[model samples]
Target: MSKKSTIQVEKVNAHIVNWLKTYAENAKVNGFVVGISGGVDSAVTSTLCAQTGLPTLCVEMPIHQAPSQVNRGREHIEQLMTRFSNVTTIEADLTAVFENFKSIVPTVPDLDKVNLSLANTRARLRMTTLYYFAGIHGLLVAGTGNKVEDFGVGFYTKYGDGGVDLSPIADLMKSDVYALGEYLQIPASILQASPTDGLFGDDRTDEDQLGASYDELEWAMLEEEQGKSADDFAGREKIVFEIYKKLNASNQHKMREIPVCFVSNDIK
Candidate 1:
């Protein structure tokens, strides 16, 4: 795919439709699975899959998403229920899984380290659930991540959210995600909702973790990639630079799969 795609929202939609059709036919996939977090990224991805005329199973794995956030996710799924009659919503509540394991270690690590661990745990649980559905019904997991979230910094949990077989929006930026949601006619309420990880209370958000808002982070990342001074973003340049730097610094390992050496010189 092109780094700069000329594909408009409508064109993206057509591509999604054809891709779904071809992949399903080739793999003989019976259904689709999507992890909907009641956030914009997830809602948009799930809606795209559902609209593609498959039995897209939208799963809301609310480990710690607030009641309001849970409601938002439910509402998104409900909205899809009307359009995709084959869509089935599942509540993959992960509270028990985390609870059973959180105290197993007894001593808590540092805040940053613990938070990173928790984030990875949530993502792994989500992947497990997606595969659970896929294994039972021969479905494909429709991962909900955009370029800004997954590739720019590799800011996802490898063997977790990063373990998906296919991603529908892997090439879109944060801004483009909103535009696609609008193009897909997702509820305006969700369109306006902030990008979040739903990993904590209502106060927790992805921007908080990255230390930069959508606009600032995107601009800085783009400038950095172009070999330009990311600090040219005016008074807030420092923050933006920090955001890109932090994500890149923290998620370095998420980008690569396990590497191998020519121990036996075997192609196997």
Candidate 2:
């Protein structure tokens, strides 16, 4: 879709809700478990799941999370629970668990490497926590990643945020995700908040690491879809396109199906 392309939120919302319900039924799961990050993607996905009328767990797994981020997460869950009878809010402070994991792992020489590893560990810990609940409740772990992050740029960490039983918004672009969020009447704070993975203790926004805004990234994706070359653009636009290409290339492994080995023997 073009930058100007719009989504029919009502139709898309209904489709996602139905898909969640059908998928959970087919999987023989009782409900869904979602990590509520207080961002538009998670808010929209959780809202859709709650509309399914199945038991939905909005778990806030905060590990060294900023106070503001934690508050937003809690408030969003509270709002969701108040609105949906089947939605429930839960908090799992995995800070101590993360610290324990860090203590056990062999220390790398470089601080940057150690910090990056720690950030990813936080996500994996949250993933593990989500599954722990899912295991007992027989629910699927619903992912909040959008199309640009999941397929285009592969922004999520492998086996971290990437580890999920289902993804409800993986097909929608970031722009479309926001549109759906607005349609759902999600709290203005979450709708207006900058997106973050909540893995980094420093609280850097996604765009901070991405080197481009979601709009620019989405536009580059559209350019790719239209067979437009980056060279066709000039100045800052070209730079943004280059950043998009670089990220997509670097994270390609995360975007593809895991490689496996197959062997066959022939009799002599």
Candidate 3:
């Protein structure tokens, strides 16, 4: 991390926790509901929610989840319960739900297409499950997206992982999330674990789908944010920039609110 980019983990944590308390108080919600994915983003976000002293429900809804993924998520939740009296953990395995959907949904002609659709369905299903729990408890659904994935490349599924009542860390950079995670005393195993969306039958990291690691994508995104020209990059850096641009363009829709039809008064 750059000296200028260094995060004041204490201050940031306080700010986010206060924000959550204020928002939940204003919204008159009971607590927060977050999908615990075993990634640093979720770990940090859930911890921040817990720090608010409100009831924070951490839901682990695994759909055919890998052992490592499940283990990390459970450990994080256990850590949270150990530290915070307000933290509650729930395990809702949706493997059967996903299988039933596969069995019932009309089969697409292509296998790859089917797999992709199912992956997204997994995300939406998890979102649905979270909201179901949240609605009954009068809690707001807290999202775990970071700045790079949420905005830079628009890497989240629309109304799926992207669906939320609040995004506490949507503004934090991926690298800085790690810094804050360390400050929050998140488990080293989770902090060091490879990040995944846990949406596929075969495990694939986010970088595997995005075509560039978070570090390279963040650098390219920073260059764009700083108004640095892509022409300045040479060789591999240029290639990464192109990849970044393509992803940013392709997933731009996910970064925005739902589009509504407009009819101008002049037109009428």
What's each prediction's clash count?
0, 0, 0
Among residues 3 or more apart in sequence or in different chains, the pairs in candidate 3 whose N, CA or C atoms overlap within 3 Å are: none
Q: What lDDT does the true structure give each of the candidates?
A: 0.78, 0.89, 0.90
TM-score of 2: 0.96
TM-score of 1: 0.89
In candidate 1, list every pair of residues with a backbone clash. Answer: none
Q: Please give each candidate's TM-score.
A: 0.89, 0.96, 0.95
Off by over 4 Å in 2: 1-5
Question: Candidate 3 — which residues are off by over 4 angstroms?
Answer: 1-5, 265-268
Report the Cα lDDT for candidate 1.
Answer: 0.78
Q: Write the per-residue lDDT of candidate 2 for residues 40-145, one digit (tens) a residue.
A: 8888889999999999999988888888788877778888889999998788999899889878889968998988888888888889999999999889999999
Report per-prediction Cα RMSD to one decimal.
3.6, 1.7, 1.8
Residue 31 in model 2: lDDT: 95
Indicate the residue-level lDDT of 28 in model 1: 84
Estimate candidate 3's alpha-carbon lDDT, on a 0 to 1 scale.
0.90
lDDT per residue (tens digit) for residues 104-157 in model 1? 855465887787777778788889988998899889988788887787767567
- Residue-level lDDT tens digits of model 3 in 102-154: 89989878999988889999999999999999999999999999999999999
